[model samples]
Target: MPRLIAPGSLRRIGTFFSDSGYTREALRDTLELSELPWRKLRNLHFLLHKTQEATALHQLARIFYLGQPADEALLRQCIPGAIFGLMQDAEMLEVKGGVAKPACMVAPLENLVLVSDQITNMEVELLPDLVLLPNPTTLTVSRFMLRKRGANVFDLGTGCGPLALLLAGSAKHVLGTDINPRAIEFARFNAALNGIENVDFEVGDALAPAEGRQFDLIVANPPFFVSAERQFVFCDSPLELDGFSRMLAREAPKYLLEGGFFQMMCEWVEVKGQRWQDRLDEWFTGNGCDVFVIKGFEFGAAKYAHERLFEANPLHPERDIEIFEQRLAYYRERNVTAVHGGLMAMRRKAGSNWVRIEDIPHPPKECFGDDVVARFAGQDLAAWATDEQLLDWKPALTSRVRLRQELTARDGGWQPTMQRIDLVEGLASSLALEPPVASVVCRLDGSRSVREQAAALAAEAGADAGVAQAEVLRLVRRLGSGGFLELPATG
Candidate 1:
C-alpha cells in the first residue's frame, strides 16, 4: 500500500530548510509544485530537486526509514508518471538509476535536478568525476554574458547546455557545440523540452571553426585536467596539459567580436624560470585584446597526478612506483612543480592590447569566477583621466588651506598617514606613508602649483625638498588616475 503523507509535515520540512539557509521560494520554483507534501517534509529538499526523479525515491528511502529498497521497482510504481511529468514541466530532471549519470544533475538558473527518469536498456549509476554539481558561479558567468551582450553567444563544449539555455532569453541567437554527439542530443532535447527557441545544438570540436560565424561572447569551461591519460568523457580533453589553454588562446579570438569578452576557467602548469603570470600572458598573444587572468587555486604535481589518475581508474590496485616517478619527472622537466588554476577574461580591443595578470592567491571555494567579471567591469584607470571628459572641477583655493597629517596603523600592520586639507567631511583627503613606500597627496589649487605645495610642506616639516617634491608628484598622479584630482586650468 502507498504510504499516506503526514499532515503539516511538509510545512515543517520547508520551515527547516528555510532556517538552514534554503529558501521556500526556491523549492516552489524548482519543483513546480504549488505545495510540498507534508509527509516528505523532513526529506532534503535540495536532493529532491537534485535527483530529478518524480518520486524522490532516494528521498523516500530516508523518509520511510527503509534500509535500501532492493531495487527501484517499488519506487517507480509509486511515483508512476511523476518523474516524466516533473521533467516535462520542470524541463530538467535528475534520474538516479543511470550508471553514466552525473553525481548531481542541474538545470541552470533553476536549482532542480532530475534524479530518476525512466530509460529502457540503460543502467543508472554516477559518473566518478561528477562530484561537485554546477553552482551559481558557473551559471552567473554564462547568464551575465547572455543578458549583457545578447546577440550571438557560443557555449563551447556545452556539456549539459546550461549556459546555452540561459542565453536563449537574452541572445538573439545561441549555439551550443559539443564534441560528443550524445551531449549534442542532450542539449537539443533540453532546448526542446524548455520550449526555447533560437538556440541550436551542434556536434563539433571546439578546435574546428564553426562555418564562418562570430560571437559577441564565447564562454567555455573546458576540460583543464592535466592527466597522464584521458578517461572520463566529460572532464578529459583531447588536448593534454596546456592544450585547452593554448587552443582557447589561439582560436577564441577569431570568433569574438571587437570588444567582445572570452571568459573561461583554465589550469596551467607553472614552469620554473617562467613566472606563471608570464606563461598565462602569452596565451593572449595574436589576439588584439585586453586579458585579465586571476590565479584562483594551486596544486602540487603529486596531487594533480593522483586526481587525474584516480579518476581514470578508481580500482587500480597497483601503485606503480616507476609510473609515479616518471609523472613527477615530466612535470619537473618542464619546470612545472605545481599546477595553478584560475579564471581568465579576455576582451578583443581595437588598438594596442594589454594584459593584466593578477595572482588571486586566496579565492573562495564557491563562485570565484564572479570576481573576473567584477574586475573586468571595475573602474578603468585610463578612462578616469581621458581628456574627452573630466570630473567635477573645484574652484582654485585663494587662501592657503591648513594641511595636517595623522598616521595610524591598520589591521594589516601597514602604517598609513591621513593628509587632510581641511576639516570638511567628504573633502579630498589622501593616504600617505603606506608600506612598500612613502607618498603624499593634496588638492591641486590653481593658485599654487604642485611644486610650490611640495616646497612649502618640505620647509614646514624641515624635510628634504627633493624627497617631498617626488612624493607630492606621485600622489597627484595617483589621485588624478583615480578621478579624485585634475589639472587646474590656467587663467
Candidate 2:
C-alpha cells in the first residue's frame, strides 16, 4: 500500500517554505524520490510553481507513469507565472506517489490544498470513520448560489470546508456550521492554514445557530444517505432514510430571506406506492417556497448498500457472496428498490408557496440548476422569453404550447397535443390543429388586433376566414405559455 501523507507533515512542508533554500532542497529530494524520468522531472522542476505548469505536471506525471513521454517544451509552455518563483516556494509543489504535482498553497489566496497520500493517512487517524474530501459539485453549486444571492451565505455540514471556503470568496459574511467538533476544528484549521479569514466555522446542527439569522443564499450537502446500518460518522445521517430531507424541508425555510434560494444535493430512498416527486413535494409544506426537484441518478437498493458499506471497509473486498446476499435481502425487506440522488433548488416566495416536482428523468449533462438560479436572480421571465414569447402573446394563433405535454415522439412523430389559448383581450381561445402541419405562433401584437391578423391569415390561405380562425386561435394559446406570443396591453 502507498503511504498517505499526514496533515501534520503537510503543515510542516508549508512552514518549511519560510526558508528559500530549504524549499529548493525539498523539491530536489522529492523529485529524486519520485524517480520520474529525466525529461519529465526537468519539465516539472521548470514549471513546479506556475499554476498552469503545475497543471501540466499533473498531466505529464500521469502520462510518464504510463510509460509515455511528452514534449518538455510543450509542457513548459503550459506553466503560468515565473517558474523560478514557484520553484522557490515549496508550498506550491505537492508530491504524491513520488511524482511532484503542482498545487496552490498560498494561505490567504487559495486556502484549500489537496490532501496528498501523506495527509490522507493523518486525516484518517484523526477523524477515523469520517472521510474528508472535496465534493466539487457541492462546491460549484454553493459558489454559484453565493454569487447569485449576493448576501450572507450559510454552509451546513462544512465537512472539510470546501463549500464554505468557496462561498467566502463571494459572500459578505460566510458561516459554516457542522455538528461534529472534529469537523469544526478541521474547518477552522483549514481556514487558518489557507490564510482565509472571512469564513467562520462553529459546532452546531443545521438550523440551530441559524434560527434568528436569515440569509439570501443557503447551501447544504447534508448526509442524505439511507442505510440500514450506520458505521461512518460523515456518511450516515442520524435521521433514517429520508430523515435528512424531512429535516431540511421543515427547517431551511426559517433561515431563508424572502425570495432567497435554498440549493441542496441529497439522496432519497424510493418507496413503493409513492412517486419520488410526491414524497419530495410533501417536504415543502408550510414554507412559502417554489420547489424544483431534479432526480439525477438512481441506484438499486442492493447497489446502494454495497457502495456505502464498501466506502467504510474498502480494504476488505473479499467478503463472501452470502454476506452480500443477506444485505440485498435486507434492502428488499425495506421495500427500497433504489436510492435516488439529485439537486433540489427552492425559492421562498412572498406569496403562496407552490411546489413543482419535476421528475427531470434526464437532466442536462451540465448543471441546469444554474439556469434556475439565473432565472430566480433575474426575476424577469420576459428577459428569458425568446422564440416562445412571440408565439404566446399572439392571440390570432390556434396552437398553444402546453409545457406539461410531450409534443414529439422519440422517433419523430407528434404525440397527442392539448393546449388552452388566451386571446389578446383576456378571453380564452379554443382551437385544434390537424396533424402534419406547422403553424405560425406569436404573442398578441398590441399594434394590431387578433381580428385583423386572423383576416390576414385567412386571405393568405385563400379560404373562408372562419375555417382557419379557430385553428389559429388554438395555436396562439398553445404557444402562449411557451412565451411565443404576448398579450395585448389592457387599459
What local lDDT score does residue 188 receive in model 2, on the 0 to 100 scale? 64
Q: List TM-score per model, in order.
A: 0.61, 0.60
The candidate that wins on lDDT is: 2
lDDT of 1 by residue, 247-316 (tens): 8976787788887777777788877777767776677776777777666678888877765554444443
- Best-performing candidate as measured by TM-score: 1
Q: What are the root-mean-square deviations of the candidates from the true structure over C-alphas?
A: 10.9, 11.0
lDDT of each: 0.52, 0.53
- Residue lDDT tens for model 2, 127-213: 333535454455434433435434688888877677777667667778898887666765665664445677888989778979889
Which ranges in model 2 have alpha carbons more than 4 Å from their true place? 1-129, 136-146, 306-309, 320-323, 359-370, 374-491
Backbone clash numbers for all candidates listed: 26, 57
- Model 1 spans with C-alpha error above 4 angstroms: 1-146, 207-209, 307-309, 317-326, 361-374, 377-380, 383-491
